[model samples]
Structures are given as C-alpha cells and as structure tokens.
Target chain A: MAETTAPAMAPARPALDETLLAALAAAAGDESGGLTRRLAAQVRYEAAETPSRVRHLWRFTDPARLLPMNLTAVTGAPGDVSHTLAPSVAGAAATIDLWPGLPPVVALSDDLPAGQLTVVSAGETAGSPALAADELFAALNEAAWNTGIGLAVADGARLPGPIHVRVHASAAASLPRLRLVVGRNAEAMLVEQHLDGGPETRVTGHTAITVGDGSRVRHAIVQVWGQGTNGHLSVSTKAGADADVLTVFGVFGGDEAKLEVRTDLAGKGSRSEIVGVTLVTGKQHGDVHTTHRHLAEHTSSRIDFKAVAAEHARSTYTGLIRIEDQAHHCEAYQENRNLLLSDRARADAIPELEIHNQEVSCSHGATIAPVDPEQLFYLASRGLEHGEAVSLVVGGFLENTMAKLPDDVRTMAEAFVGPRLAAIREGSA
Target chain B: MSDALLNPANPANVFACRNLHVFVKDGDQEKEIVRGVDLTVQRGQKHALMGPNGSGKSTLAAALMGHPSYRVEGEIWLNGERVDALEPHERARRGMFLSFQYPVAVPGVTVANFLRASLAARRGTEIPVRAFRQELNEAFATMGIDPSFITRYLNDGFSGGEKKKLEILQMLLLKPAFSLLDETDSGLDIDALKVVSDGINQASGPDNGLLLVTHYQRILNHVQPDVVHVFMSGRLVRTGGMELVTALEERGYDWLTDEAAVAEGSRT
Candidate 1:
C-alpha cells in the first residue's frame, strides 16, 4: 500500500478568523506548506456550517493552536493536525495544546518524556453539536504527533514501565482523543484513564496504536464517567511478525458506554489478546465490541469479556474473530461471560468467527448466570451473614476468571473492577 | 404429675419433659412421632435413650433442641425455665447443644471461624483470639483431633469420624449447659468411639446434663450412662438403672415386651 496524504482546502466560512489557522501553523513545527495542505484535505469542511444555538457559543470557529512544543513539527492544517510524538532519550520539552476555550476549563499540560516513553494530558470543554465535533478534532490535532514516537529498537529490546497518558475532562461537555505509536523490536505499556467532572459530560475519543516487528505492547483504558456521562472509545492496533499485543478495557461508571477495539495481526508469529470487564447498574448500558483480523500466516488472537449487570441494567457484547486466507495456521478464541444479579438485568453476547483458511483453529463461547442459591446457603450456614455470603461468592466467581491474568495485569484488573463490584453489591443491598 | 416433680423450687432436676408428644406432617396429616413420655435428667446426670430404628428416639432429642419440624404437645422445662416456645438458636443461646448425626458441610468458611461466631452469638461479646485459640488447641488435643482441622472449611471434605470429632470439639468450646448427643457413635470405629466418648466425659461437668441417643450399647459401655430408657412404638415403656442396660444387652429388645406385659399385669 502507498503512503497517502490528503490535499489542502480553503476555509468553509470565509469570516472564520485566519489568526487561529496561523497559530495552528506555528504549532505545526515543520512549517512546511505541503504538510499544511495535507492536513486540510482530510477535514469535513462543511461540518463548520452546522446550525448554531448561540452566536456567543462560537460553534463554527476554525481549528486553532493555543500552545506549542518544540520537540516535533506539525505539518497539518487546522482540519487534521498531525505531529510526531517521540520519546526523548535525552529528556526534551514534550508538551502540546490546541486553542483555549471561551470559558475557563481545567487544562492539563502534556507530561515530560521519560526514557523511551512520552505522555500527553489534556482537558477540553465541548458544547452542543458542532462544538463537540470541533473539540474532538482540536484535542486530536493539538497532540505533539510529529513522526509519532518513531523508534526501531533492536530485536528483544525491553521497554521498562508503562507510558501513562491521562485524558481528563473537567467540563460538563468534553471530547478528547489521545493517540500513541510504538516501534519495531520495542515493548511498551500504555494506560489511559477517562475521568469526568459531572454527569452531563459527553466524551468521544479515538486512540490509534501500531506495533512493529518483534515488539509487544500492552494497552489499558479505564473509563469512569459519572451518571449521564456517555463514554465512547475506538482503538486500532497493528501487529507485525512475532509481535504480541494485549489490551484491557474496563468500563465501570457511565450512564451509557460503548468501547470498540479492533486489532490487526498483519504479520506471522504474532498474537493479540483482548480482555474486558464491565459492571453496570441502575438502567446503565455497557457495550464492548472487538474485531480481530488475522491477516498473516501463523498468527493467533484471543478475546475474553466478563460483565456484571444489576438493577435493570443492560449489557451488550459483539465480538468478531476473522482469519483471512493469507493467515493460514492461525488460532483464535473468544469467550464472554455475564452475571446477572437482579431479575431485571439483561445481557446480550454475540461472537462470530470468519475463517478463510482451512488450516486455522477458532472457537467461541458465552455464558450468563444468576447467583447460585445453593452456594449462598452454603456460605450462610458457615456463619457468614446473607450479605457477606453473597459478597464472598461473587468475589470467588470473579476471581476464577482473574486467575488467568498475569501478575501485573491481574493487579490492574482487580484495582479497576473490585471496588465497582463491591459498590454494586452495596447499592443493591 | 406429682407436685414435687413439677415444682420450680425443685433444684435436683436440670431438664424435665412431661408427657412430651411430638408430631410430624405425614403427607397432609400430622402423625404422632413421639407418644406421651415423661423423662427427667437430674443435674449432672448422663442418661441414654436407646431404641430400635424408627422408634422416635431422635424425634424426642429434636423436640428438646427446638427443631421447627417437631411440634410438641407437652411442656419442656430446662433449668426451671419453660423452653417449648424457643427457636433453635435461642435454645442454643440458653446453653443447649445438639450434635447432629449427619452434620452439613459448609465450604469457604473455616471451622474455627464458625465456632468463634457461634460462641460470640452465645456470649454477646468479642472473644479474645489468644484465649479462643488456646481453648481450641486444648480441646483438639484432648479429643485427639489434629489442630489443622480448625483451619479447614467447616465439615467440608471431612470423613464421618472427623465430622463426629469436630462436633465434640464444638461442644467442648461452647460448653453448653445441656447437650443432646444424637448417635455420636454411629459411624465411628471402636477407637474413634472411645476417643469421642472420652472427650465427652472430659467436657461434661457437674452442671451439664446429657441425653445420649443411640441404637446400640457400644457407646454406652464406654460413656457409662447413669440411667437407661428403652423406647418402642414412640413411647418409653421401661426406665431403669445400669442393670437395665445390661439386661437389654443380654436379651435384646425381645425381653422388653415381656417385661412391659408383666408390669402392666402387676399394676392391674
């Protein structure tokens, strides 16, 4: 496939201030006219024409840069801001930002880069319709994304600790997109946490990650938006030969949340594992969808998801494991388990297998269950009160699934899921 | 009923069941399981209730322990207090213990924790861990049971003999004022039976009264009941001293019919 870049385009609204574009150009460190042109062609120019509720709201403003970092150049225009985010082996100034909002909002500066790892943190205030879309684009375009953390470590190069990026929204409405890139023969762990300020906040974000040959990356996203907050995440990963990728998506607190993760094993001898756990209650809805494409020979992938629903809550899971013709000798496995703690709770599981290669092995299974009365009575008879008995049994039930995780992964899983399950049990009681 | 036996001022008797009649629901009707029977165990006395299978000896013990399934039509007094209306745990709180013939297993809860919880429920205070452990270790040593058993799930994965020994261990820790040993020797070998009987004898004090429920004389030979009562047709037809246990052992329950007939004839 050829490396493609979009064309440059004029502004949709002539009156939209060119000063914002000038600031964005300055933030795009390269200052190359071709790069700026490439950034403009990919944007939805007419999106700025959406009807506005308030003129003071400034819904149709052009994409602007509020702050600039010197580490990487951004060639793209306001429409699609593209810059490189590379780890500073010698400790460089690593921060980036877009235009500040009309109203004062909590803004977090990008983190200082550590050995072979870089971090970016930001908060955006979004509003009705067009502002929401604009805020999403602004956050994505403002990242120091030049050459995008490009590095090709030698085979068997071990990257130490996780590269942590925190996307925080302190407004009633915000959309933040955090992106990351990894290199060949290098290993990296990335943790992203989505925290909200209020119930009315709405977030839509996308993270694009790529792994190089003989490298491994473990990525995790923990979403805890308050009541009425809607959280959406779209993640994409590409693995090379002998590369391993693991992703844990935990959804605990949200009015309604949908997490979609897609992984592509583009080379042979690669493995990708997707694991997720969700706890929802009080009319809450949780949706976890994963797509695994085995595009190379001798690649393998596995997906496991567990959810607990209570008090009229609903959970839906849709997963796909596909092995293409070129991916012969591939193995894929998928499983989903749901525990319903109340009669009104509901769970829906969808597992699909699409195999074009006859030499591949693939399997999928799902299960939904209510609390076992016999187990409850057994615990109660042993002098644990009814509540404690149920708690212990529930803990045991979830622990069985956790036993399959590695040490660090298991600790992360427990820290993310344990308190939420406990809270649900307490709320039901 | 004589006034002397019924008087609350009488301090000699620890438990008195007067004409106690128990019934069980058979299909849609309440069928009598324990006919009219008067039994008394004096303070510090250890007596045995021996009978054939289906003779309602266990029903009497259940009635004394306030089993919800057993409905009594008579009065039961424990230590001068009427206990016919109490619940099982309430009766247990009042220093009553019943060692089940078949104990239920509970997984994930250690035996020591269960014992401490039950003891706390009875004593209404937090027991010091050091004191509790000391007493538990002592009880285990006396009963010849391994100390590791206390750390396991209550009765879970335990053998029949181990379950029986655990029951005795619980009895020792709780120190009930009165205990009903229901076929404690049913599944035990001779050595286990001896160890269990010895544990019971060591735990039983001057203030604790016991009623042993069994079908055989094997346990009685080791425990040495102060009195023996033979139950038949849901009623006790004969009550006697140690000699009576020997008689029942020598001739079996066949002589009980002749002995009952002669007693009735002489009374007439």
Candidate 2:
C-alpha cells in the first residue's frame, strides 16, 4: 500500500484558527505538527456539529478546553517503561512496536508462520464502521489516520499464542489504528498495550476487528497510558456467520478517558461479547460508551462493563443494544455497574435499547451504587482495615469484567489495578 | 472460650457488653433487636448464646462488632478497652471478629488474598507472602476445603458447607482476641460440622474468648460450651451453665418467653 500524504479532498468546513493552530504547533516539541494537524481536522469536521445528548457526560467544547496536548512526554529514559511480553507467558511468535515518527518495528520468532502480518492505508478497510466517527476525537482520528496494522491468521491456525503489540504514545496527540483480520475457521488473540510518560500526555487510539466465518478471536486493549494522560479510543468490530468475537478493554490510568466501542453482528449465528473494566481515582474522569448492534438472524451479543471510582474521581457508562428489523430470533443484553469508593466519588450509568423487531429479545440494565456494606463488613470483621477492605472490594469489582480477558492480559491488568486501588484507598484514608 | 488464661491484676475478660441495646431502622422507626443485654466472656471461656431464629442472637453478635447498620448503645469492652464508639473495622483492629451468619461474597477477590489482607490489618504489619500462603494452605486442609478455594472469590457462589467452613477458616487465620461465631454450623453437613468445630477448637486458646451464637445444640456437642445463655424476645431471659443449652434443647424457648411474660405481668 502506498502512503498518501495528499489530504483527501472533500467539502470544506470550519477549521481551527490560524493563531491557535500555530500556538498548538509551537507548544508541541517533536509532536507539534501532528497535534495541530489532527486538531485542525477535528475542528473542520466536528467543531460545529451538534452532539447527541442521550449519554453525554462532560461538556464538549473548543479544543482549548481539552486536557493539554502541547506538553511533551519524556521518552525512554531509564526506569521509564519496557516493551516486552510478560515473563510468565512466553509464547509470542511475532511482535510489533509502534511510536510517533518511527517506522513500526517487527520481529518474528523462530516458530512464526508466513503471511501473518501486513500494512494498509485507512481507506482500504472492507466495510464501513457501524459506529460513525462523529465524536470530535474519533473524527480527528479518521481524518488524520495515515497508517494502520493488518493481522491475518490462517484457517484453523491459532497463532500458538497472543501477538503483542506495543504502542508508545507521547504527550502530543498519538493516534494509532489497528485492524485484526481473522480468517475463516481460525482462532487468535491480540494484546495491544499503550505506554506513555506523563504530566500532560494526550492519546487518541482506534481499533478495528473483523472475525471471519466460524472463527474465534479475542482482542484485549490494555491502557496504561500514563498516570495523568488525556486519552480517547474507539473500537469497531464485525463478526461473520458462526463466528465468536471477544473484546476486552482494561483501562488503568488516565486523567480523562472517553472510550467508544461498538460491535456489529452482521452474520447469522454470530456471537459477540464486549467486556470492559476501568479503574479511576483522584480527580480522574473516565467515560465509556458502547453499542451492540444485531443485524442478522440468530445473532447474539452481551455487553458487560464495570468501573470503580474513588476520591473525587468520576466514571460514566452508556450502553446501547440495537436490533434491526431483519435481526429476528436474536438475543442482546447490556449491563453496566459502578462502585463508588469515596464520598466524593461519582458514577453515572445509562442503558438504552433500540429494537426494530418485536421478535428480538433485547434488554438493558444499569446500576450506580456504593460498595456493598455486607461485603465491607465481612472483610472488615475479618480484621481488614477500612481502606484495605475498600481496596479489596474495588479490585473485586473491576475483575468481574477482567476475567474475560486473556490470561497474560488479565495479569497485566491486575498489576495495574491493584496498586491503583491501594493508592486510592490511602488517599481517601 | 477458656477460663485458663485470666490475669488477676488486669481485666481478665476478653469481651464484656453492659446493658447493650441495638436498634435498626425499619420503614420510619427504629426497631430494637437487642434490648438491655449484659454479657461477659473471660479469656479461655467458651460461652454459647442459644436462641431460636429471629430471637436476636445474630443481632447481638453483629452489634458487638459495631456493624454500622445497627444503632448500638451501652458499653462494649474488649481486652479492658471500651470499643462501643469504634467503627466495625476499628473494632476489628482491636482484635474483635464476628463470623457472619451470612458472609457476604466479594465477587472477584480471591480467598487467599482476602485472608492475607485481613491478617495483615489485624497484625498491624504485612505478612510475608510465602508464609501466608503456607498458613492458608494448612487452614484449608484442616477445614476439609479443597485447595481451589484459595483462588476462588470469597464466599462467591460457594456451597453452604463451603461458606460455613470458610468462616471457621478465617477465624483460625485471624485469631482475634475475642471471636464471635454466629450460627457457624447452621448450614454444615454432619462431616462439615465436625470439621468446622475442630477448626474452631484449634483457633481457641486460653488467651482469647469464644462466643458461639447458635440455634441448635448439635454443634455444641462437638464444641462443648462452658456457659450457656438463653435469648428470647431480644433479651437474655435466662443464663446458666451447659445445662441451660440442654434444657433449651429439651424444653424449647416457650418457657423462657413465658417466664418473661409472667414477670412483666406481676410487675405491672
């Protein structure tokens, strides 16, 4: 695939002010141009559009209101971060490393098979996204997407183990798009990890997944995108006939994260399971918006999202189950639950369902509640202090959804969440 | 509870509650669950509070631990220090433990991790991981619990026998200054009851006190009680030795409630 530098010619809209763009560019060190360029595209497409109000949390406004994207994240200093597979699980046959301004670094193991990887431009994705790129950051990612990864697993092959994809985002706007294409009757798992150093890191990530007929695929996005980074991600998936797709989002640390995930069941008898676990504390804000669309007969999808927020932290969840007219005999369910860990912590849950066919079975439920008192009492009466008990509860709350993640990915997620919950407990205590 | 470890100069009692009353909100009113109850458990003494269902035995145990759901009044002293004003966790830090009748499930927290955290909090320091694991494994073996319980979530989806065994397992691990066992054997099978009773016996010593809140005397046969208190209508209507448990088992609680009514009738 040829790299296209020429902008896709299209109708003009409101673009970012020249002065503001220049300031954004000047404030960003090595990442200035990319930030300004993406912001420009964002302003052009989304600045004036009216946003849907059904599941809105934070107010969307000018780029000036976003968490800072101009500061630079220190890169690869000693003790910063390492890009490698976990020590316990060692069977990765191939690895892909991504960062800003650097070509993707790929290394193959001795057991790697042929035609497992390729590269393609954004325009070449076979089907349109079921979820529109109308959100400001999502739109910006689309208008500015220059490179993406294409992973193909052959029929009846299981890749031996997961393929590790390490993404390094800077304080500037680092937008990465990934497409995992599992061939017919294949099985595979992808573990995508995000790493950044912060005080003011900004990241916008996008992922596309397509599971071929009768195939099974597990995709995990582990976001340790800096302790105080501002980030956004959108995941779009399509499942073929008789295919099974599982997507897990393990969000650890970020100042503010807006995640949008949508799964499309377009083939008969296809199954999709979307799961997410988010841990936020101490002035951080995380929002998750997900949609499961059943577009074919006998399709089914289950969406489970759980979050823990503490010490002035806030979390918002909005999930939708949409069933079309021809999608009869389908089953779809969405459940969102939040645990408040401090007096100042807040959670908002909104579940929506849109069914065009009465024959379809679609249901949605949401709950925002304090940690269960009985659970706390049981732990505390066992000699755990309040903070320790709360930490245990918070860990448990987040892991209900984490159990769906691949084993290695689950371990990584636990490593990030355990300390985070402990920190939150200490802060509150 | 054993009477073998009492110190004369100091307060030898492991736990004492004087005129304790507990009220919980029901609709628009505070309904009293424990009314004017006085109890004392000396170090090395095993006392059983036996009563029928809804007779406030569990409420007394809960109130003794300072459960937030109930408004507790009067004085509760543990190891000579008054702890009525303490939070449940604070009371726990002071070496008080309540084996819940219905232990809540903490869905994703593994049993081993939960026990380790609790033990650390009780000890005021961290327990080494390897040592903690070894101790937990031993407890599991003693309680006749499968090794898989170490990784399973606390009380989450456990069978009745498993949950009951876990309560005793935790009691053994924490080894509080005073442990209140609330209906710990109600849900256990015959073999499970024996295992739980044996674990409780192992956790017991002269330096600590054990208070068993039970509705059946079947478990008392396994873990013998030195003192027995008959509870009825949210109050201690009668107190005696192990003979009281045998009497209640043979005669039931009707006579206790009848005696209270006659006493009130004559006083009025």
Candidate 3:
C-alpha cells in the first residue's frame, strides 16, 4: 500500500522535538493545572501493562498517551480543517479542523439563524464531561486534549447541514475530545474525519455525544491513516427519551488501528442504529469492540459491523448488547460479518447479549469466513481480472455500511477512503 | 493425432482452436476434463456442437474462453493471431465471448453498471451515460426482458429463465467477433427461446461467428446451424448438415455411440 504522503498544506510551525513529549508527559503540573496533572499520570499509566476491561486480542500497549509538544489547536476563523473539508460540504455548514500545531479552529456560518447553532471550548461551556474519571483511556484524553470542541444546538432548531471536523495527527500523540449536545427536538449531523499523519504519529481520540429528548443526530466517523501510524479511537453516545441516533464507523486503514464504541440508550423510546466497516491489509491489526446498552423502557438498538481483512492482516470484532433490569420491551440485535480475502488473512467475531429484563427481546449473530470463490470467478469470467474482482467485492462490502450515513457524508466518506481501498487491494495483489 | 488438428493457424478463420486440452485440479489430483479438442469457426458461420450429459462440451467452451480454473495446453488462434497465453479478459478484449451455462451472480452490482463497465473495458473507452442508457433500453426491449432488471443486482435472486435471458442480452449488447454459447437455451421457454434466437441471429452477420452448444436440438430449429457435429465422450464422432440434427432427434445419441462402438471393435 502507498504510504500516505503528509499533506503539504501545513504551514510553518514549531518543529517537533523528541524530548519535548517526554518532558510534558513526565511532569505533573501544579494543582492549578489539574488537567495537566491527570494527563501526566495517564501517560505514566500507559507505560505500564494496563489490562483492558474488555477481554480480547486487541489489548492496548506501548502507545504514546500524551498530546505531542507543539500540537496545533486551530480555533476560530479559517483553519486547516476548513481547507480539507470537501468542497461539496465547504459552504453547507460551519467547518473546523484540529491541527497538531494550532488550537482547535471553529468557523460558524454567520448567515444562520441566531441561537440555532453554538460552538464553544470546554472551558467556555458547562458541558458534562463524558468520560468518567475511572476510564483511564478516555479520562486522559479528556484531560490532556487542548482541542476539546463543545457543540450545542438550540431546542427545536434544525441544522442546515452537517458539522465537518478534520483532525490531522502529528508526529507526536494527539488526544482529541469532543462533546456534542443536541437540544430538545433539535436535529444535527456530524462528519468527523481522521486524516493521516507522519510515520511516527500516534493518535488517541475520544468523542461523547448526547442526544436530547425528541432530538435526532446522525454521526459518521471515518479513520484514514498512514502505513506506520498507531491509532486508538473511542466514541460513546447517549440518547434521551424519544431521541434517535444513527452512527456509522468506517475504519479504512492503519498500521495498528483499535476502535471501541459504546452506545447507551437511557431514555424511554430511544432508538440507536450502529453500523461499522473496516479494511485491513498488509500486516496491520484492526479491532472493533462495540457495546449497546439498553437502560430504559421501550428502547431499541441495532448493531452491524463488517470487516474485510487481506494479506497477513487480522481483524477482530467483539460486540455486546446489555439490557438493564428496568428496561422492559427493549429490542436489540447485533450482527458481525467478516470477509477474509486471502489464506494469510484472519478474522474473528464474538457477539454477546446480556438481558437482565425478563420481558425483553435481544439477539446476536456473527460470521467469519473467506471471500466467496464463486463470486470471484463469476466476476473474472466477465472480463475483470481476479484482483479487480476481489477489489470490487471488498468495496461493495464497505459501501453497504455507508448506507447508514447521510447522503453527503457517505459521498465524502467514499471520496476519502476510495483511494486507500485501491491501495489495500494493490498490496494484497 | 491429425495434421489438420495440429495446424494452429487458419488465415480466414474467425476463431481456430488446435489440439486444445484442458485440465482442472480436483483436490490435490489433476484431472483432464477436456481430453483434446480442435475447432475452427469461419466468418459469418454458425457451428453447433451437440453432445449428451458429461460429454465435456461445456468444459471445452470454458477452456477456449480462457477460464483460470482450467489449465489449457494447446495453441489458440483468433483471427489469425496467437492468443492462448493471454488471460480471460485479454481474450475478451480481443473480441471473444462465451455465454455461460449458469452465469454467476454478483450481489450488490447492478446489471446496468456491469454492462457499462464490460462495454467500456471491451471497447477501451467510456460510453456516455445517455448513450449507454439508450443502448441498454433497446437491448432489454429486444430480449423481451423487463427494464427494471437493469437496476437490480446483477443476476442476484434472478430466476433460472431470467438468468438465461440476461446472458443473451449481454451477448447481444457485446457483439463479439467470435461467440460461444454454452447451453444458452437451458432454462428458456418456447417464447424466450424464440426471442433469444432472434437476438442471436441479429448478432451472427457476415463478420461474426457463432457456436451453439446444446444437448437438445430444440434451439437448432430456430437458429439454423451451417454445420452440426455430434460429440460423444469428449470427442467429435460425427459431422453433417441439418439432416444429422433430424436424425439425432429421431433416434437419439445411442445410435452414434453404438456406431462408435462398432467402429472401435472393427479397429481392434
């Protein structure tokens, strides 16, 4: 696969230093800098072998936990993210990009209805911290991230389009934290993209979404990285009474990519649809762990994840659906399908359900198998080469997951990941 | 075994196959499916190869089409050009087409998209959307097939008869110089058979060649063949005109097998 060439648009910024990260991650700042203290502690905790609460082969280890020194936090006015936002979505909505060398930049459209949309830094708004203090991975991200973007939509307000966030990982580790709050009866869409960084760039990203009563939110997160990068990304969403959330996760490519997502439906009549797809090639390892917890009465949840692993790559998926005791009339379903493209590729899926409510309905299914040979020959006999046929099958599998995304976001996602998919196929061939 | 079969080139031939043998691997063992086949199709000619079940007729067609699963061990000449070493798509690009007996389905791929891509690859240029749509609609209407099938997944969930019709629709749209139909009439009713025959006739003009492989003589009635050859046990036993097809319909393949047996006994 072609190693992603670092985007040349980055302007002159403070050069990255090796010792700077060691110093920032090693020091426990004063009590006034409590966030820094927590970050320092989290960095140290990452050095040791910390067992993952979720059991699997994707246990995290040896990854840089602290934000890199000189990480750009682009904030306010035109920023780097505005440039990367696809032209199709450029003028549709407010755009932002969190660069490693600048502060989190946010540019809201002035022509929109007043009080309809608002964006603030974590300190400016009284937004609830999504990650608990005990969740070390997410806690460190929340504490150390300098680009914590807080979004709020007014009650009964409908956004014209989606908020596009393009984050560029740097040579050093970056902790990106997001807090989104959709007000009552409001609707919004969020398209978050993770762009590739340098060969040594390590990224740890965390996002928390809160859907208000009777509100709807559709979030699509796509990860596109370099050949020598390490990534740990987690997204946790909460839905309120009568609220709906459709979230799609597309893990396009990386050297070592670990994605964990959780959706908690705590309000009555809340619904959640979670879909994801991953493309793993080379010797990369891609893992996705998702959990859907139905904690309220009359709530429903659906989870579908698909992965295509080729070359010596490996894909692991573990999903669980937990219905609490108080949640009656809950309906939940979880399905995982993996396509292994070669003999060297490997895939494993584990789906589980825990229903404490006796009167609930829940089911989980998983399938892990090689790509169908019959389909390959069929396409090949029609004049496509074997490689092209395999590539088409893999692409169709990935595109099926995009059906959950909005039309604009899906188009952008395809434009973003299509070339990377071609690279994956090339490497496998 | 014969000098005629060993000759690899026929300048006036649209497609010439010389001593072609195809083998496929069953588990770890190599099995020769098409023992040896020599065929030649001239311009504007239709040759029918009829045989019973398991006679390797379809295997020979697949081998000539350059299917990867079959290891071909003979020279293939198309329009006086050597092309046995080429891949299937290469053969297709050089104007060779084979209508599969059981065309495989490609889920999530629409027939319109598949045809557009195949046409583009075959012609080495992009076809405008409007032009492509017009061509597809015309072909669909000509085949008596529903236009909605164009948007449906390619051959996915298609009925047996529908799949056969779609294959002929592709053959009509592609218009290859040399076409091989392997049991194209397998799942067609009388009406569809007539439509498909009309489509075939439209393609078989003065420049293109057609070979219709079938176990029954029902299709031969509509699409008359210039030459009819009876193939038994992977070898061509007899060749004649339309009278041979009538004879086979009247007596079946047993007579040909019995004649072959007697000829073998006499040789011994």
Chain B vs. true chain B: TM-score per candidate: 0.93, 0.94, 0.93
- For model 3 chain B, give the 10-residue run with minimal summed lDDT: B1-10
Q: When only chain A is evaluated, what TM-score does every model earn? A: 0.69, 0.82, 0.82
Q: Write the per-residue lDDT of candidate 1 for residues B1-268, one digit (tens) a residue.
A: 3668566436667787878899998999999998888887777889898887888887788777776566889878778787778766666777778887877665545777777866775676769999989988998998898999888877778999999998888788778777889999999999999999998998787888899999888898888899888988788888887788878778888778777667668868
Q: What tens digits encode model 2's per-residue C-alpha lDDT throughout A145-208?
A: 4233556677677676677777776536565667677778888888888776476666767887
TM-score of chain B of 1: 0.93
- Output the worst ten-in-a-row residue range by lDDT, candidate 1 chain A: A122-131
- For candidate 1, give the lDDT: 0.65
DockQ of each candidate relative to the true complex = 0.09, 0.64, 0.42
| Model 2 error, position B140 (Å) | 3.8
Q: Rate the local accuracy (lDDT) of all candidates.
A: 0.65, 0.75, 0.74
- Candidate 1 chain A vs. true chain A: TM-score? 0.69
Compared with the true structure, what per-residue lDDT tens digits does model 1 show for residues A1-429? 121322323323212123444443344232345234424422433233432323212211111211111122223222111211111112112223221121111222244234455332211112101112233333333322221211222334455445444344333334344445566788776666555435555454556666778888887776765577665556767788898999887777677676778888887899999888787878888877788999999898998888888778888787878788877899999999888888999888767788897998899999988876555433332233445555555555555456555455466556656665566546553
Clashing pairs in 2: B1-B44, B1-B45, B1-B46, B2-B44, B2-B45, B3-B44
Candidate 1 error regions (>4 Å): A1-115, A118-156, A213-216, A261-269, A272-275, A290-304, A319-335, A350-365, A402-428, B1-268
TM-score, every prediction: 0.57, 0.82, 0.85
Error of 2 at A332 (Å): 2.4
Best by TM-score: 3
